[model samples]
Target: MSEQALSRDRVIRTLPLTHWNQPHHDSGALASLEQGNVLFLPHLSFTLMPEELKLLDPALVAPKRKNITFDPQHNRVRGLARQQYAQQVTDLLSRYYQHCLQLIDALLPEYRHAVHSPSNTLRLHPVSTWRSKSSWRKDDSRLHVDAFPSRPIHGERILRIFNNINPHGENREWRVGEPFPVLAQRFMPHLSGYSPLSSWFQQRIGMTKSLRSRYDHMMLQLHDAMKADRKYQEQGPQVTLSLPPGSSWICFADQTPHAAMSGQFMLEQTFLLPVSAMLNPQNSPLAVLEKLMQQPLL
Candidate 1:
């Protein structure tokens, strides 16, 4: 493989999340993360690579669909848990985690205990796909933060780890469409047990109208402008990432907006891992691991 490809492969092996001790706030790569970008890390020499990517595949990592409560309203969905996938991805993640702990230890040695026993959970999103030659605009999925109002305040810090299994560049490019304004207008009020159309009277009409009318107006304009630009192309239905096999990304769920594109001959799978402050605990073997990461033995 070319050096560039080799470098990419090395990065896949050494995920920043699993390897680095703590984020180098002073480094350009780590600083970008404060602005909601990922800090990619190269794999450690001792880390083991999965013989087959399928071992860490979302379908295999998670359990078969089971009825479970999701959403703030306790809405139900059938799916697997993070621990289920952890078993499959554990060795791979352990390598990355070890490195991450070291960084964290160096920066916050006093709080190392908290980093060890972090309350971690995993939830997987159902994989959806579209084939090639499909219309991209009509299929445009809007961009929005992943947070829900119903989740606990701390839950807001949760990072949703997305793993893409499709071969690189096989699917069309996925784009993050323009953000929508008037959040209420974008969602049907009736779905929330409020109906602007069926008001007690016209007294509330002005308020509802003001909020709902502006929905997606700005985004629609931006979309049109983009299409008019000479750079517009009928892209496929997939977002391409140069992630190596067994590699994953830690993204601030509520901060980043993501979506897949539309196109033909596309196959993609996704898994969600929830990383929280509670992963490390006050007293646990994991805590010991967290402390070890902080101190470098000379």
Candidate 2:
């Protein structure tokens, strides 16, 4: 795309806050989410206590650790130094995770019962000073949808809440691309068919946490293809999003094509919502691809 065209597309790509302020069971908010539009909460924030504020320092981050991860399933926090403040960090993240859940329940009430707890993660990270010597697949700078190589979600929707806590009032830059169905149409023909033998063998050898379904296979391939394509990375249909300090946004990461450009002091929570619980299940990435391919994905 030309500079002028890209600049014109830079308009904020988010659902209005009025939708979020609607009733807890509002269908407008749910429909917006189901359509893969981000719900931008500019006034929403995770208030940090005095002690919790210390965790935002870039020095607290461990070497080679991209983010401080809190796994509720294991009740542990990783990627942070200063064991003395581990409990505080855990508490802060736990509270943030719960905050995200409350918002999700309020905005997307239908997903309350379908949210998977064990698969969720609360993460805090600094983007400004972090650097990784990684390949394209691991690079968040490249626009791509969410897909886990080790954990196959069996077509579950990946819902995520992100809060920018930058103390210096910097913006968390991100570029979001075209719709999920548009991306699938561009790359589906290039992806290989799923092999049952390979899926079973990988699960048996513990290479994967669970059996990889056809849906998972296609998603991983599409994820890689989007990142691998240089032309698409530079000229794809997308818009830039600048999330300011104290701003929080929620979206389906698996359905939204996104790339984190730059920022610092970010708190993120991931939640898995079952496809069956969606307000419009057919609008999900799984269903979109299944319809395009004319076959059952799982």
Candidate 3:
């Protein structure tokens, strides 16, 4: 028998801030997210501390879309300290990076088990965005899933936490499409076989940060195929959510088809969750691919 399809109501849910930090894990909610669902948290309010508000002023920060990352490793702040990237502005924005991390950890379960202990690597992406008109890969205008050639996930899920922290009452607009399984079934036939040698060559020549695995190739193929298809990019099933400033949302980006239409000044946090921890592992890309290919994928 064919498996049951996920519904719109079951996929997207809105809940209050109180539901976030409960003692026990919400298995239903967790299942929804693991299976390409999105949590529309309009009531999740993140009020910046007075100091944070002053330091992270949108007017003061640099307008470069490619330079939104605020991790200490990125050194955007150090550049600020050295009178580069407008020292006064970048310094102010850097101060709030830690606070963004703390907020996401408190709000999501991707990092914690039912016992309330940390379970996964919470890779907080201190990305404050500004919409760009660059090439399709660099641009956020097209509908696509999140995948990086260098960051081969090896079947792990890409969970994301986003905050529409737009100042001046602006909203961060997004067009989120349906679940991944539907799209995968439609496009799987078109993707070419993954090449291990080619991937190794790319890593050796510094084309990728690391050796691209089969999972990486599959994700990259899915991303490119979906974006390149004009019909899917334009007429695909989707819903618009104009998230206001102070609101937050969470989703498994790797399994969800999405497009950023407009609006900016947003904070994004990324977390990696294991397929084994999922409420329904069969629903993940790793399991789905294994079923489709009639072999283990990861």
Candidate 4:
């Protein structure tokens, strides 16, 4: 398809926030968390043809690894589907990126430069746990910002698009962790030892008296909080979005804390396509097309 033909705005403008529970704007919510402003688009359903699903089946997608776990704090079952879906996923994401860029261009024409970057892309984390259930634990998981220090804030946004390929009337919920910014701030001082600053300070001035004292105080508070709050340990914000086959949800990765639990029906599967830093100022369609026109596509 021609580049121009690919440029149609795809955002659902009527509902400012796609998901029911999301804040009207993510900036204010993120500020409450002591994080930078963020934009959240939810309940975004992408129309994927049956042929596409068939193309992504185990035979074509291939399995990369098995019994791999993602939770660092606790052990969870995980497996890599395979790199076979790499090219297919890239093509799909490229199209989705174009759709997103068109929407951005329409919404903030002046900030068009921001959308001119190649979308940072990665294949799905293969079906991590095919058919397994594990109890959630605090050491199992905790809330934190998605991006690291080095990554540019502009492209740091994450796209978590979920495609539910289940029969009609399947009851399922995506339990999101709570946004405890106050708790995060109170706990930050204690996490300092795990921070980059601690390493630098240790190298420069060995174990200083003041530093040790500060660390001790922070750890004590953190320990106390964990022990005191049973609800904080056992209870979390778990909401189920009953998505039938062909429906999807595209959400801001950092804004929402998420974990999944299987439904009553034993047979279940979900396709997740996560894209990071791909639609920023550098590698977007506008930028790439400009370069291609300068030196025609041979």
Candidate 5:
């Protein structure tokens, strides 16, 4: 591994992020995230009030990987929640979704961040209440970037908004790993080249979702590389953070290497931001990898 690759300054040139502790969103917030920084904000506490919580299905707070997912197309949330309480959950989710949408528009004026309609999947992860298994998809103990094998993101970025809603005053613990460029530098050379023929075959057989693009392929390879390396997992440079209840955060999960160490009762909203929204589109992972390889990536 090259020492230059591991240098923090050489990896990510991030802008200073402003913390939104109140009910306010700044346009700079979008730029900050585009620059690969995380912003912490005050949560929308009114969404899940105490009474609303009582009505929620036990599966939501249950010690497991159960959570209601909102379909943007159908405009509804589906989970193990009871039919009687379904309307309540649906109403809450509708408001919550609108709040997030307003937030993005307020913070990203002039920035062309087109969030695909109905692509947002809300997850209620009760990490503390659940037992974590070693399955690659289930285990978030190890630091890694957000990459989906079935969901080919192409060159688009994964912008995630997370809220720690632990009603009992519990905080979620997370470990932020090294910069994306640093990780890529360390793992890129070891990754095999993307095979177009294989991708076509997989897409033909329904093995790959929508056809795994080269960018997605590389991202998956990098994710696997970081997770498979035991030495890096134990001794990598990182910072641990405890996100308290009533707090929210925004980040490009694809760029930020993070690990869910502990804690639970978290609500997450996923969004896709286009490369054109960046202050400098060339700084994106797709462009960065292209520059590094001296060729087009996707």
Candidate 6:
């Protein structure tokens, strides 16, 4: 086989990406994201006011939590000073979350309706200091798609918006890996069948917020399997991108395999998009896995 053919056989999937230095809601950008590519906007930014910059301190992170977060659903703030500065922090994050939603609506108008009732939050990672102490499954430095063991999503797409807020002009380093289909094929066969009994037990015991579906079970398995594989973590087909301060990017975290190598003082929002809302539903992880396994996942 030729070198290129050999590389393909080895499971390396590489594709060109257009970095948006200027905002565009055109079909091309939407098409690229549907294909599981990152919509990196080099100039798209959320500017923090002078006084708001004081929230950058790492000391604000709550004990035992990796980052500070504001959950709009409950109007609560976690991992930050909750006594004197709670309201201030909450207001800042809430505004930022709404700002992210506005960008999504403008950039991907097709998804505007699907963005409702999203479990969105604002998270500030003070530093990469938690890396060494994190467990394998919790480690963000390993290439893995987003999945939640405690929350059962039932195959909803995980769209995330990230902004690097480092005041020092540092770049958030990330290693994004192969397409969802390619990564799934490598790990799906190894995943055992899901059990209804186990799902019920976990939900009843409060181990999971809700009953885990077959789709959720498979996704968690795939997520853990990918993170635990040291060889794949080191040698997987991937590309590293440095997101400089002030820049923001958006992607379907569930469809894109990525690892945060290093960064600090970043804000992010997570939006859940139902599979039915997708322009090209077949490109979703749920759809791709269903076709490969020859069964309905959700």
- Cα lDDT of all candidates, in order? 0.32, 0.78, 0.63, 0.34, 0.67, 0.78
* Clashing pairs in model 2, backbone N/Cα/C closer than 3 A: none
Model 6: weakest 10-residue lDDT segment is 1-10
Give a tens-digit lDDT track for model 3, residues 1-298: 1113434474577666643443334556666677687877786655545554443433443344233344443534321222343543344344344443454455544555521111111111122243343656655567788887676768887777776656568777677776787788888998889888998899899888778878778889988888887777667777666778778788888888777776655666565778777767888888877777787655
Task: Please give each candidate's TM-score.
Answer: 0.37, 0.90, 0.78, 0.44, 0.83, 0.90
Query: Tens digits of per-residue lDDT for model 4 on 107-225?
Result: 33333463232333222222224323222222213323233222223223343334443434453343344332333443444442334466346545754333332323233334344
Instruction: Please provide the root mean square deviation of candidate 5 (C-alpha atoms, Å).
Output: 4.3
Report how far off residue 94 is in candidate 4 (Å): 2.5
Residue by residue across 1-298, what tens digits does model 1's lDDT show? 0122112222222234443353433443333332344333323222334563444234432343311222211222223354444344444444334544455454324334543222222222222422232243432233333432211222213333333333332332333321122221223222222233543233354422322211122223233333333322223111223444334454433333334443222112112222333332221212222243343111
In candidate 5, what are the lDDT values of residues 1-298, reduced to their tens digit? 1232244432233333233222334555555666666666544443476677764234543243356767655876666345666666666666666666665655655442467643443345555434354565446777788888777878888877777766778877877777666668888887889999988988888877788888888888888888877777777876666777877777888988777877655667777777876777875888877877787877
Model 4 segments more than 4 A misplaced: 1-44, 59-89, 103-112, 115-172, 194-233, 236-250, 262-298
Worst 10-residue lDDT window for candidate 4 reads: 4-13
Residue 166 C-alpha lDDT in model 1:
34
lDDT of 2 by residue, 1-298 (tens): 4233443223233444333234454477678777777777787766788777777776666777767788876778888767887898888887877776677666766777888853333334544344255577888888899998989999999998888887788899988787787789999878888899999999999999999999999999999999999999898888878899878888899998888888878888888888989888999999999999999999
When superposed on Cα atoms, how far off is each prediction in RMSD? 14.6, 2.9, 5.7, 15.5, 4.3, 4.2
- Give lDDT: candidate 3, residue 86: 51
TM-score of 6: 0.90
Scored by lDDT, model 5 comes in at 0.67
